[model samples]
Target: MVTDFIELGFAMESGREIPQFSRFEGPVQVITRGPVPAQALADLDRLLARLRGEAGIEINRAAPAATLVNASFNASDVPQNLIAVEFLPRRQMQAVVPNAACFVVPNVSNWSDFVANRRSSAIDWTRVVSRTQAAVFVPSDTTPQEIRDCLHEEIGQALGPLNDLFRLADSVFNDDNFQTTLTGFDMLLLRVWYAPELRSGMSKAEVQARLPTLFNRLNPSGRRPSNVDPGPTPRVWQQAVEQALASDGGLVERRAGATRALSLARAQGWRDNRLALSLMLNARLAPRDQGEAALDALLAAAELYRRAPGGEVHAAHIDMHLAVQALATGQAEMVLDLTARALPAAERSENAAFIASLGFLRAEALSLIGRTNEAERLRVDSFPAARYGFGTEAAARARMDEIARIGTAAQRLARL
Candidate 1:
């Protein structure tokens, strides 16, 4: 029997009938356009370097607005392997894919090419044999952390996996959006992706036959016990999750959808990260009057996540929410404990926003316990990460004030 890890490898490689293996045939040269932020440029360079060092993929940033040419792929020719990445202001990006944070498409070299072929089947990823030229569009107006995240996931997709699996607990290739950065598993997958033995356009059966030996040679430690495959996700549950998380939807309907998803997860007997995610979504959609119920659901989800593999970051996210509730209710020690548990995971995951947010909460909890000096130091230390995490000084100040207000409210309630 194929281990669950191998199944995961197959699931990530092909979301369609015939396996689609597409990647840069030579050294990847990335070009950028639009009014890109200084921070974004710096992060992109770092991402490329990491890709080179960690995944053994030769990728580097090209000169700004580098000339792009339409050329056919020849394994011996290197210049035809260029991939251009453009940073568009949010408006232009949303015009292409409404509300998409970022995306990568094969067979297109620039924005105009993408716009013209957006509806055509010529840009279809499955049909592509080898990636000669592609475009990655990331928005410039979002938070710095968001920009970094987009660079990691989109560039990874441009070079490796085209599908997001919810069952993947430790990868940015997961749509759950918990793990913000590329993980060890992701790097291993990419290394496997670019292995010389694997070439573009291999059939699913062809690739499947090779993966067992490839994984054994590349990742010897992966032979350990694997998580039981949860099987394919149901379309009804997918629809429910989409409806529940839709940015613009009636609250009542969204809550109903979350409830339905939670019911479906339970019916499937899922005890993995997916079940925990369902619980978290349901808690987020809980009505204002049902605060206790929401807290209960979050606590349950946190417990489930704590037991799941690669769930430290997921548990940290839940703890962040729980810390806020604890702070609001004047449970200073509980807030401190929750933030303590969450901080290391946030830092390990390279989520500056989470680190800053947890720092602010910890400071408030410290102050509530009369550790004024320690609280002030923590608050001051959090500011740098806060600026990067929140994108602007004003936004960072707003977050600090927000946390302060929670502490003040809790103090007043305590006095009562």
Candidate 2:
């Protein structure tokens, strides 16, 4: 099955058929290379949890087979069922994987960096379809979240549904890495491959032939949205907004860029986009929530949105981020209200990433409010979007999960 995909090169996706594995029978093993800190192992644990529990697909979480600093797949000695996910430094990737076809995880310092470092042919792309072995290259001194984002993407590609399609807005498999976690769409593909009727070693033609029928049968109501398109592309300001929030250039440079972006947004009459950018700048720079005056400014900004010509869907985007912040500050009740404002807009739109991020926040709110079962179900539903929005490693999710678990809502609220 792997050999067949290797000859297929870049996985292509149009409207009709989705990319998937011929067979789905491998135990993914997460192993650290070199001197990885204990925390990385913990982060891997969280990633595996999301993959095994939240993927919507039933990918079993197995223990790491063994750690290998200098390793190559002999293909003979290594068990065929053992697919190793080696986490190592980026520079060490070529050394570990050698010339053998493999997937190289993309790592970015920030969104800007992500934009800069996309799709280099020098990096091997064939291993994703290879029978076994892949690498998650970690740049030195990167945050755990960054490393996890690489894992979220690279590991997922290694698993199956190898194509990274621009049309796929919600899945982590998308090039944007906007949704870090495995999303529902990703789960759908996995389910197709692993379903009892679907067997290992099927051809693309075979899978494509039967998939549409299987999907319809499995989800008669079409719970999964069509993948033809991902709504409208994000606004230019939305893309540039990252420049301001990320600690790139000097503070002066970042501030200047952000100011200009906001000014242009307003001049162009993009009220909703501007509002969202303003809140983002405030959160990253001034952090109005830290003081009464700043809080007033925030409220005034939110109020402005209410009156602005910005539509409900755009407003929902801002609300999603705000809901996450509220959750962080232990305002679970407020998060419920904040996320609620986004829900109506969310349901009315086909923005997959937006929906996933919003749903994950709602789940956080539910968990904080003690709706465990509902929250868990929502978390499972969130799948790829949760990671895509929060970084597949789910740093924000992890922090909130810890906060919600360690203390009562009141206690958490008081601490903040």
Candidate 3:
């Protein structure tokens, strides 16, 4: 005897067919057509017993039995003992049989719904602000007012109108159009403080050209706000030195004038720490006949950093800048010594970018002292890690260009 089971009632919206499971006893048979038979009932009882044992349930507790019949296959000669039982689709079975545990089948259609049900909340800005301040090494409540009020009264007089300046600064800080606001206020401040005469002399286009340098002198430590979406391009603090040189005549008078204004402002309690440092550094690098005065100014800056408590990082940067100045001035021995001192600080602080930079400086000093091979080796060793940590792919590319130039220069000199 044979048995066949077919489930017709169960279906899914996705049009996919569902599978059915059934138990069979004695050779269950499928009938195309059948009458009520006693033997068939016996076969069903046996199948139910087998199913109950497999499911670990008693016979009475098992689900209600279903029968299958087809008129086409009915025959008198067929054994009356044959019975056919049909099982519903697994999903339908769960709905029909109370207390019968069923496993849920998953499908791709509701993936987005699952994700939407489990989504999280938005970020908290206050916590973000605190964390950002900590990461950047900025102190809590380090606002411009606290900085401005710390300077001497005489310095405040040099700043012209304090109320107007503060208002403009506030606007710059709060406005979404940071660069535009900064540029506008800085131009006005420059006119009032530095070169009142030039304000009337130059066109808007000309004023815009000179605005960047003035802005740099004003906010030397922070990144500038640019008109473009990504904001101002990253400029090294040393660019101020170049600007000072390129200013009217060979004197770098604008840089000196800006520095004096900043110093006065700082004395009056202006919190221009970064700007102040940049000005001092530019003053030291200024191309004046008075080398002794420049050296003294540079020493004063270094001393300021050295004397300040917990300013070791600032001191390290000063040391590196001094070393670079030494290299530019043909003092290779001093460059090597300063770089050597800076390396430990750079490494101890885990500033790989600084370490890599010092390595390059050391290499440059070495090359100047007729140690080409050593210089090349250091350049090759430091290039990769420095490139990664510095976050300036173009600067790294430029360094490689410089290395190539140095190699070419060495080769040419050897031929000579």
Per-residue lDDT tens digits of candidate 2, residues 50-105? Answer: 66664444444344466665554343545443334444454544454453222533
Give a tens-digit lDDT track for model 3, residues 274-311.
33354454555466686676676666655654553223
> What global local distance difference test value does model 2 have?
0.52
Residue pairs that clash (backbone atoms under 3 angstroms), model 2: 178-388, 179-388, 180-387, 180-388, 181-384, 181-387, 181-388, 182-383, 182-384, 183-384
Candidate 1 — which residues are off by over 4 angstroms?
A: 1-18, 64-79, 225-227
**What is the per-residue lDDT of model 1 for residues 1-416, given as tens digits with 9 covering 90 to 100?**
13333444334433453345567887888877666788987898988888998899998888644533333223354356766677778898887799588998887767777898899987887677788877888887899999999989988988877777666678898777889889888888888888888888776677778878888888887676655667877768877877888878899888888999999999999887778889999998898898888888898988888887678899999999989989999999999999999988899889988899999999999999999999999989999999999999999989999999999999999999
Instruction: Tell me the deviation in Å of residue 285 in model 1.
Output: 1.6
Q: Which ten residues in a row have the lowest lDDT in candidate 1?
A: 67-76
Per-candidate alpha-carbon RMSD to the true structure? 3.3, 12.0, 33.4
| Candidate closest to the true structure, highest TM-score | 1
What are the lDDT scores of the predictions, listed in order?
0.82, 0.52, 0.38
- TM-scores, in order shown? 0.92, 0.46, 0.35
- State which candidate, 2 or 3, has the greater TM-score: 2
On lDDT, the stronger of 1 and 2 is: 1
- Superposed Cα deviation of residue 415, candidate 2 (Å): 30
